[model samples]
Target chain A: MSTIARAPEPAKASLVNDPKVRGLVYQAVLVVVVVGLVWAAATNAVENLRAAKIASGFAFLNSTSGFDIGQTLIPYSATSTYGRAFLVGLLNTLLVAAIGVVLATLLGFVLGVARLSSNWIVARVATVYVEVVRNLPLLLQLLFWYIAVLRSLPEPRASVNPGLGVFLNNRGLFVPKPIVEGHAWIVFAAVVIGIVASIAYATAASRKQTRTGEQSPVLLVALGLVIGVPALLWIVLAVVAGNPIDFDMPIKGTFNLRGGLQIFPELVALTLGLVIYTAAFIAEIVRAGILAVSKGQTEAAHALGLRSGPTLRLVVIPQAMRVIIPPLTSQYLNLTKNSSLAVVIGYPDLVQVFMGTVLNQTGQAIECVAITMAVYLTVSIATASLMNAYNSRMALIER
Target chain B: MSKRIASLALAMGLGLVGAGLGATTASAQATLANVKQKGFLQCGANTGLAGFGVPDAQGNWSGFDVDYCRAIAAAIFGDPTKVRFTPLAAKDRFTALQSGEVDVLIRNTTVTMSRDTTLGLDFPAVNYYDGQGFMVRKKLGVASAKELNGASICTQQGTTTELNLADYFRGNNLKYEVVAFATSDETFKAYDTGRCDAFTTDASGLYSERLRASAPDDHIVLPEIISKEPLGPGVRQGDPQWADLVRWTHNALLIAEEFGVTKANVDQMVKSDNPEIKRLLGAEGSYGESIGLTKDWAVRMVKGVGNYGEIFERNIGEGSRLKIKRGLNALWNKGGIQFAAPIR
Candidate 1:
């Protein structure tokens, strides 16, 4: 009320009125609550474990598993530790995932192109396949393959032999195993040398073509360098070093097949289910990617008097790949994750061995589950990083 | 701006930790009180095992393990219907118990050292004494498991059965192939389809599975019993009061059988002059009170579900299709191994 020097009144600062301050306070409360929760959970787990007299920690990793796995990529025994079982399971998972990805990609590309084929029947057939396979649940498809298809095969005594020393029975498919004896390393060395020489010849040929504008039949020369050299070395090794490649054919015993490399039916059924199921999705992705490229691009290429094959290879494909790559990476990841379904068919994948068998045996639920999750996470993260590197290279370059 | 967001995120994380910690600190010993308040005991059972725990077409559950759960219900409420059944898979059975989703798990689970110690479960009674055996087609000419060398055997994965099979083969220096499936049904199906030379599991399971085959008379379970499988009901640890109740309930059934008390005659036997029978029927002492149960708990259980012998005969004995002989499962006094401790 006393009108002294009237300086402009400073605005009163309220914590709720200031948005920044309010956000900070809310966040601070959240952090405190979350941290307290995590710490409490950890403490509770520890306390409960101690009270139950259950041993905690990862010391069980080195303990003798005292169990046998049906199929192991690494050399493992009942005497091996649980750690070895994990490695075996991991390798088996990677093997199937890698093979499934390769096969799915090849089949997907072919089916995708067929969906857009000029022939009406081809396009309709591809559409039917994609619709039917994609609509079915992968688990049911896997069960059907394992039970209805593979299990329905004839008995060991009545095995179907389609020639070439390959035998198919309910047990498995057995093929002639090539046992390389003495001096086989020389032939392998020669094959390696041939590959190196071919790469060198290819580089030189490409350089000559680029500089002098003189087209060399580099493909033919490289083929000769690769195949011709290998064949000549094989002939020398066979004649001079005594044809050491011996084939071990499977003999039909009373109850089973013996003495050959047998591909278990579980492996076959699992791979077929994964490849067929994932290819349907990948085919749709590929088709969409190709269609995403405008019709104007194709017309422009045709107007340039370029033929269909060259036009597709030089113009359309490069552009479509830019669209296809990111989705394709995701598809590969999906296939890898889906490989865990191998447990259903008893393929001895990581989940089956580590989570199913070892977990049950050890009764170390928390530890086993943590290890299994860590493995899958690492595999996925590694795959994503590799795909990202490839995707960035294919990304559109803006000036 | 980025610094502000970072600090905000950090604060949010701490708040979440507080919430989570608050949930985990709730430790209590009130399972008995909880069950009484809930009015119905939660019982975990097998999803479907023919002679053990199977649901009928009308969804009425009945089997060996199911009867055991009903027995517990009878002891608690004097009514066998006062129970809620949760059918759990082999892999999820322990988790269901540990998470307090079920009060007791009587799902034909085996009692092993690792399971008892590591999973925080207590198995107070061995209701079924089972052993691993192999089943083969009569035409396979395999009379014993030893003759199963080089045979592709169909077995369920994630079971002690698989480990035992491997052990038997390796010990005998024999080579064999295993065609494992995720479920017991799948293994049986694979064996039925002739994909395997033999099917292996518990002898009791083999008999049950054999009945489901296209030709039941064509399969014969081998005579060799490979491993000891003491199957029983599992309860969560840290609940001594609840565990005692379950233990005494099982013993009451056994003791009732020892005293020759059947469900049809339990009412008369409760008035018997024999002190042992009176004690078991909960008339002579305060045994039931110690376990937080009524004095008539044994009478209620016996009158509702009968003695252990009756339960066995009704479910898996000659009265049922499984037709398993109670050789090892017979009471210790009857030349077998089921020995229940004294309730006192």
Candidate 2:
């Protein structure tokens, strides 16, 4: 009864005066302007292309490329369609990016940890490596690796043979390729079965440890299952079927080493350059991630009678991973994109083969550039989402 | 919501009007007028192909292709020096021309069906008649290209030579690996370092590149000529007037050379009585005006860069260090196939 009369409801505001209406109007205008710009740009391009008398469209993908790539992952020739050439280029790019990511991460982690080591020599060496590598431009490093280091190697006639059917020369590194003959599927099936069994065993062992407070040599057992199963079967097949696996050893030919998997110097130099350059940045990232873990956490683990190794692995690393994942994804993306410098060294990567050769051949500037851009966008997005998913999994779970 | 829709419609209307205006501006095709306004001809030349289009230590460009660009400038502006050279890579030559960055591409670009039609380019005339060939080290003992089976060949990318190398090897049922670089220098360097067994390019280019080798005498060009490469000056396809001007400039040079017009004697030849020479020297009909140039256009061109024979000799032929024989580039009446249309 004593409650004051509520203030009269504000008079209905005019549409122009209403904040919500103004925001909606502004947004609508912005959307209209954006759409108009895009429409205008597209139309202008079409009009210009038409006036220039340049043929437009994606039909040229079916045309013969009439060019040969230095390094091809798939079967390709001058007679191959431009579409096939594109796929070959894409696969080559993916191959380098994948290998670069894995090797760079491993080297980076080692260097990062070594930089913080108690041994002065190890720490100083790691610091010098990171500083020197990161300070140099990636393109310069690539050129140095290709021209100064790899190209200076001996010619094929005087190739450096470090035994074991491996040869190194200016042309390439030729290594014996393992040729699996007859019932290769059986070997593949064994690998799959071993991996499945090892995973199941790991789960069961962890459950048992929690229930009975017991421990098992989980890593040792997993490794044995994963590697031993296939190896045992391989030996058995070799005895029964006169060697299911044989190595095609490389032999000196007239111009180069023949009859082996030839890893061209372009690939070697590109990979080496990318790995060394990206590892420097990744080392700093890893160091920052490691240092971000609180000192109290380490002390607490030590007080609980855990050693430095276990404390770092179980308590500190798990927390540090939460800090490491996001930046690590960026470094991975940078390495992938920077691989385009392969064109300078004739690596036959996506930019080298497709954008450079294919674009010049077809003169489809718009289409080729659009496709290359779209490819990079897709790859970046895919890589970002994967790291984001991993980052979410490692995030703290608060009650 | 209705207001938002109305605003969008209004914005779209304005955008359409702007786009229409843009279309009208883009359709303007007076290249000569544009070049005149700029007061210089933008010519695309090779980045560095020695006798074809190489810059000297003083950064002054003087080569066969560079002189061709100079001749064009003389035809248009009556001043040979009223031109600029944009050195373009093999991969970027056509795009540079297509994007209007250069009025003409006098680079050693081969005239092919795809380039003429699909690339929206017109080849005025074959300034240099070339063919793909191979160069190998004498130590390799490769006497002929036929013996180059299983050889790794280095070549400049984005050229007819690369394609011809592949075709020749494939057609002959031979195996070869092609390592193509983005520049002629890289290709030659790779070959010199023994990264490849052979280097393949135009026969003219082979001779030009051999001079840069550490030991020029060590390498020898093979006798095999693989493909016909009619290297010419190219222009945008839609502008026929510009095409005619370029074509006529080349023809004038050839006609002058056929009538024995040299750079030193071009001034004296203008007073001659030969009907064809008088017509070519712009002393006859209004032929030069028809192509948007003054009556003395050919006179300026010949005086500026000399005729075809003079240009060839001074840049890449006997007078130069290249010492290349005229071969197929000699005039039609003088044993070679370099025939040109009459100025009349």
In terms of TM-score, which candidate is strongest?
Answer: 2
Residue B308 alpha-carbon offset, candidate 1, angstroms: 1.1
| Model 2: residue A106 alpha-carbon error in angstroms | 0.8
Off by over 4 Å in 2: A1-11, A211-213, B1-28
True contacts kept of 2: 0.46
Give me the overall lDDT of model 1.
0.83
List model 2 lDDT by residue over A1-399, tens digit each. 559898899999888899999999998898787677767766776777787777778998998888888788889999999999899889989999999999999999999888988899999999999999999999999988888755579988899999999999988888999897896667778889889998999999999999997988889988888888888888888788777778999998887888888898888889999999999998998889889998899999999999988997899889988989999999999999999998888888888887888888788777777677768866877898789989999999999
State the C-alpha lDDT per candidate.
0.83, 0.87
- Clashing residue pairs for model 2: none
> Each predicted model: what fraction of the native A–B Cα contacts (within 8 Å) does it retain?
0.44, 0.46
TM-score of 1: 0.91
Give DockQ: model 2: 0.39
For each candidate in turn, give its C-alpha RMSD to the true structure in angstroms: 5.5, 4.0
What are the DockQ scores of the candidates, in order? 0.36, 0.39
